[model samples]
Target: MSQPKKTFNDLKKDIIDNQICTSCGTCEAVCPVNAIELKNTIPNLIGNCIECGICYANCPSASFDADDMDQKVFGRTRKPIEKLTGIYQKAYQAKTTQEDIHSKAQDGGVVTALLTQFLNEGGDAVIVADLEEDKIWVPKPKVAKTREEVIKAAGTKYTPSPALVGVKQAVKIEKLEKIAVVGTTCQMRGLSLATDGPLKNKKIADAVALKIGLFCMETFNYDDYMQYLKDNDVDPGQVTKFEIKNGRFYAWNGEERLHRAKLANVKPLIRSTCSHCTDFTSEYSDISVGNVGSPAGHSTVIVRNEKGQKILDAAIKSGLIEAILIEDFDKEETLVHKLAEMKKSSHQ
Candidate 1:
């Protein structure tokens, strides 16, 4: 009575068969020897794979076996609290005005608020994406000490950003004690996959003490977003405020302004992979934060785990956030509205 040995190929087969792979490209990025390539929405494992198990370990969809084991061993199985629940409304201190954080943020200042709290409390680092010289998005996992740096990194990236690229670097280089990560739903799920199984990379998972997930409707490809700017006579260089407001997009570049355009008007340029996605909130995250149904300048906070609640409580105590209770948040209806928007935009 011995357990069967698992091989890399076996793992690969399971991943392909499951059809759960979002193709975030973490496996390709983590391979020490440059063995994996993303081809046709799937990973083409090429080159010399030493079967380091990085690919198998990083595949988010490879958790079927683990889920099964959890059910068998624990007598019952459960997903992370974040995933099981859709959304929750909680109040936070509004010490910083929406204008202060909003002006610096992409849309709402929720991302900046969460990151600032972690950094002020002596958290090691914050992982985020920044605009690059070549117009390509790059991951920057900074060891931030000041609120200024944290604010600088806060904003929404509407592109298919490689947010997970910094996970490995955070583990090996900074030797961080605690790190707060912000990402969309797919990226959070990818991180979740990296934490489980025999091939778990402890450095990446253990260092991530706080997971702040942003609500994602759909992430457009970089080209599509750029084209959206162009079609609307927007100059990428002159762009100031880019926001999704009231089911429409508003762009302000210094004195010039654009308004009342549905996201569907920019449909030709969206990423194809986004259409197949179903998760709007990063279910695996400890807390999911967004501005979906809240007042124009306020953030909607959903605390899903004990860690999330504790972090939020500490932030409030430190006078970093203001709290307010949402009377009724129609989670399902909101999701339906978002989905319909995505579909309408895609068709356009």
Candidate 2:
């Protein structure tokens, strides 16, 4: 059974004392009703919260607040593992016709399809990254609803963003009940921390109904990406699609012309923090989704929790997705291959 939902005041206390409030003003930006304010790097609830739980749900620092457990395995829990195993046991791969969505998406249309399923299932909202000022280079994380909004936020961020910056506020304002988060492996690690440890808060963890983690090779800094575009004589503004596939950097603009470059040519351009990261797949998340081992335009999904499995199963039943059996992914081998490929491509 689910824990009893907390009131707005209960959530506010958790934020003031427990969570890391990063004064990003994300809660202020996404709140449908002006109920929160940022003061001295902390959110101040100004108006009466509607008990929607949006603020609590979106808080990145909010803890899991269950039984005490090892800090190292915060978000990496048994629940997700059981779910993942179940999915893998029944796993199958198939091609999807949702080409338009797939074309604009970061990997396959799997992320979009999952997000759509959540929205259709009475989910309050989805937390994702968006252009801070309508510029591709400037990403500002935000929670959204409409298909257009999610699409606009689509594509790989390739940067270490404060994507979980708003989670605390969502819980405080009570504006969200069930939220689905799309984040990378590092972000999922942080979420795991929040879900475990003494700082764990029940209100926030319960609010985060789902987490969708993306497979990350590494994230690039915004400045580096812009510089790479300039050096390649490619205008970042004209580029409509950018992807790293088979250890190659693929970019395209308005015309059908495609520019394929080796991944090695771009390694020096990545963020310093990404190199130290070892978890390419977010083991802590409810579901890990990416295109690591799948064919071009196909997503490899690892359902990590019963909640995640239930959602995916429902989507399949609804005909929103198709499943097929494929070779089980050996995580260690896959990582080694990815690293080797990146190394080889970088040398090219």
**lDDT tens per residue, model 2, 1-348:** 997655446656765554434333444443446687665435678887887665555443443322233224433434442322222222334333466666677666777777777888988778787766766655656677777777778777565555555565455454577788777765665565454433444555677888877767777767778888888888767766778887798777744545779989988877654544445555566777777667776787776557778877877777777766455443424542454345335531
Prediction 2 global C-alpha lDDT: 0.61
Q: How close is candidate 2 to the true structure, as a TM-score?
A: 0.70
- For all the candidates, what are their Cα RMSDs to the real structure? 5.3, 8.5
- Estimate candidate 1's RMSD in Å: 5.3
Scanning candidate 1 in windows of ten residues, the lowest lDDT window is 82-91
List the lowest-lDDT window of 10 residues for candidate 2: 81-90
TM-score of each: 0.77, 0.70
Task: Give per-candidate clash totals.
Answer: 11, 27
Best by TM-score: 1
Alpha-carbon local distance difference test for all models = 0.62, 0.61
